[model samples]
Target: MTLQTLANAALILILVGWIGIRQLTWRPILVGRMWRLPIVFAAIGLFALSGSHGASSVTAVDAALLSLELVVSLGVGAAMGALATIRPLSSGDGAPDAPRFESRTGWVGLALWFVFIGVRVGIDVWAGALGSHLAASTGVIFVMVAANRVARTAVIGLRVSRLATVAPVPAGAR
Candidate 1:
């Protein structure tokens, strides 16, 4: 397929994946929600790799670049996920359940999700359009998605853990 054809195909698949993510997360949290993004992105990466022809063949440079990008992207995802997961200890209604800060977190996660997608598509296009030998081959997609998911999951897990901690008394109470 032509380069543009491949890019367009990749965009279409990404849009489909994005839509799936939105639909999957629109409802209340479920046991399955946590794993959906990582799995979907990983599956997409695998699909991209399979179609890349000769993806199994890689040079040292490509390996190194992928590794570096993975680490950097993972760090980026973690930082952003931290911002996305911020929540207040309680709600405005004086009820333990009603929450304002918590609601925006889902939107934050969704925004970060699209940010990761943008990075993936931008890098893919750059690598393809330039044909730079230094650029990561198709395998970068898998690593990028893996990095994003791992960091995001870790951050979210940390957020949940923090939620379990006992709330500190306000200064006036002390």
Candidate 2:
């Protein structure tokens, strides 16, 4: 493996560890904040792709595999978001007027994460076997991850908005 490949692998491992831990915790569902990571990741991925593999060099196989990876990522992410447990924080918890929901993915969510990783790795291996290296580029990984996060964020945002409408803030707590 090249140094770049090793670095990319290390980065992926660190991201998986950090992101997985965060998802398993109970954290406030803030849609605005949730959008940041995915957006940034997508931009970085796009930049990397454009720089590393220009349009002229893209093969049909690479395109097809990338599409499949993206679809899988989005699907798995939506599943993870759907499985998340969202609950309203009590007034005693804090900010009674500014009602908020806390979310946790728990073990099942973690398992889905593994499924996502497994499918991603599998796709990469398949791409390598097919000699479509561009399909398994590090840039593609970021793009796929961004797609996954975007799907999860959308689902969670919808859930949070629905919950907010149903959950009223305490009177005079504003």
Candidate 3:
């Protein structure tokens, strides 16, 4: 398979593995403090690898565009993440339940992911397939968005499950 195909396959495998692990493991994996460092490192490593691949594949013009896209995407994602994090913090209804946060953040993340993906695709189509660097950059953006959305959804579900486990039910409610 080509590099693009290989990249796509690897992304799919990572997604599936994450889901499978979450489903099969009875105990909470990320709940432990030790897992935090490793998870962060793994994320960094993945980003590095993907960034290297994207840099190596694109031309200089495309690279610049891609870099700008990366910055904008990351800024938007960070803003959203912060917004999601802050919403729960601001609510005076005691500590926010993890499941509720997970569900709310998950939907928001998914919506943002879809919007970004759609925008990238729309831009590419509008630019036409006339062998332009913008088209190629948009393609890369699309792939990155797909990978991110999958990872985000998996994490969201895991958080939701953990929150559910610890959540208290109403006294009279069954």
Ten-residue region with minimum lDDT total, candidate 2: 90-99
Cα error, residue 133 of model 1, in Å, equals 8.3
> How well is each residue in 27-139 modelled by candidate 1, as lDDT tens digits?
32222365677777777777776666546666655565556667767876686557653444342544443332341235555666666566655655555555533343444
- TM for every model, in the order presented, reads 0.58, 0.89, 0.38
Query: Which residue pairs does candidate 2 place in steric collision?
Result: none
Predicted candidate 2 versus true structure: per-residue lDDT over 7-124, tens digit per residue: 6678778888988898789987778888999999999988888877444488888889888988899999999889999886554445443437779999898888888888888887
**Count of backbone clashes for each model?**
0, 0, 0
| Model 3 TM-score (2 dp) | 0.38
What TM-score does prediction 2 earn? 0.89
Please say which candidate is ahead in TM-score: 2 or 3: 2
- What does the lDDT read for residue 25 in candidate 2? 94
Please report, in order, the local distance difference test score of every candidate based on alpha carbons. Answer: 0.55, 0.82, 0.43
The model with the greatest lDDT is 2
Clashing pairs in 3: none
By lDDT: ranked, best first: 2, 1, 3
Highest TM-score model number: 2
Where does candidate 1 have its weakest 10-residue lDDT segment?
A: 23-32
